[model samples]
Target: MSTSTISLDHVVAWLARFRELVTEQQSYLTELDSAIGDADHGANMVRGMNAVVEKVGAAPATAADELLKSVGMTLVTSVGGAAGPLYGTLFLRMGVSAGPVAELDGAAFGAALRAGLDGVVARGKAEAGDKTMFDAINPALDAWDAAVAGGADIAAAASAALAAAEKGRDSTEPLVARKGRASYLGERSTGHLDPGATSSTLLFQALADTVTS
Candidate 1:
């Protein structure tokens, strides 16, 4: 399969782009969460990403695992509520799977992503149709795998992942929340899009931006 090789530089660039996107969209995310959640998804995410940016800038990590592990640990400590642990686990697993590598091809990156998704599932105890970030993340990973299998490069695969993530995020609107605080609202959660799912889409979109730009 054809692949786009992603270096440590690309990983750093991706994180920076993700931080900017999350910061810019913070209020929108908070609004979404206010409908059915603790209403701090935006604040928590922005705070965590800002910490990540600060850490990265202070002491740059040349190895892939070192950089991602730092991102994971920062989120785990700083971000509040469910988003923190879930995203922290995602990065932690990805870092472990990435080992000490300096770069990854599309296939290797896909494996790392699969590990991250698994970590989310394990940490969140959620699955597809749970009306959570898993809805977006699972579909994006699937699409990324399929795209790579179909010979798509990193940019194309990331684009496909973003598209699938959007569809997954949209799919959550009609779902009755089955996990997290949103589940407390039951049927009231129906018709409102999940903040977690929306944020998950933003994550994939940032990943795509790293390649496209």
Candidate 2:
């Protein structure tokens, strides 16, 4: 596969892979959430991603922005809880940053990812160590930028991002929650892995799979 640029097909595959992963891990996600939240993270993500894939399939998009925006809107409307708005904001901002394009080069994709991360922060008001999705996403993007700076192609960059995301996700396990429903547990949140970070890891894993496969 050519790594110089990622096309709309790549994006669509990424979403499909994400949906597959979330469905496979739905029970694990819900179990993690049950320990620190309302126990709906897995089911909500599965439902949302299923809707996103269906919506995208129904309305074929000619451009990256159009496709991404459709995905964002579908998730926002179909999913419930914080996951809907935060994930929606991420994809919405990414689409806006990508503009009217059929494909994205490494730099363009990285910039769009950064924009999405910033949007997530704005929507969730989460920072590093907040034990939220930001922990995983931020580090993942940082590694992405670094890989791009080293002239790595999309596959390599995505691999780097996934590794960083997993590390960040693991890092969340020891921290006391400072945001979202987990925060209510205080010290009780210390031992369980964060549902948001875990799902965010799946997001990158899907990206990696799409590019490498």
Candidate 3:
């Protein structure tokens, strides 16, 4: 479908999915986080996403960019720890790149997501192998770009992206921490999965499921 056909409903649906997924995986996320970081990533994310859902439900935004920006701001204000600012900035940049639109096509959405990743990089200064969210998000965006270049539909492209993200998240388990709180642990962080990578993977999975279903 065309980008213009992606209504505000799509954005709302994606947010809902984000809340649901994070809530469902809260314990797992927290467990993973506790190993390397402060152990509040999952709980913090759930709290932030729930607040986002409430905000969206109370006064639904008409524009896609506005809705995303609202989500980003809510996360920034509600969630604690480094995740709050990192993820918050990601969405804020996404909103800016998306502009005040009602809809977006696969290519436009991909570009907006890439912009978000750029923001994450700028804010965190973490590279792909740093065992951060970039590990998952970077590969996911790359896969999406590849899928789009291959003339895949949005749903197909999103699916590919999610798969790549999941793989990236999984791959972080054996990595030595190189950024953020986990890096403080040095070699001690080698066996644990990165909480940020896990959450980032969930975010893309939610987006893929929401738009396709």
Best by TM-score: 2
Local distance difference test, each candidate: 0.91, 0.94, 0.89
- Candidate 1, residues 84-183, lDDT tens digits: the string is 9999999999999998999998888989988998999988899789899999999999999999999999999999999999999999999999999999
Residue range 1-213, candidate 2, lDDT tens digits: 648798999999999999999999999999999999999999999999999999999988999899998999999998898899999999999999999999999889999989998999998889899999999999999999999999999999999999999999999999999999999999999999999999999999999999999
TM-score of 1: 0.97
Say which prediction, candidate 1 or candidate 3, comes out ahead on lDDT: 1
Of the pair 1 and 2, which is ahead by lDDT?
2
**TM-score, candidate number 3:** 0.96
Over 4 Å off, model 3? 1-5
Clashing pairs in 3: 3-105
User: Candidate 2 regions off by >4 Å?
Assistant: none
**Per-model TM against the reference:** 0.97, 0.99, 0.96
RMSD, every candidate, angstroms: 1.6, 0.7, 1.6
Question: How many angstroms is residue 13 displaced in model 3 relative to the true structure, after the best TM-score fit?
Answer: 0.8
Better of 1 and 3 by TM-score: 1
Model 1 weakest lDDT span, ten residues long? 1-10
Q: How are the candidates ranked when ordered by TM-score, highest leading?
A: 2, 1, 3
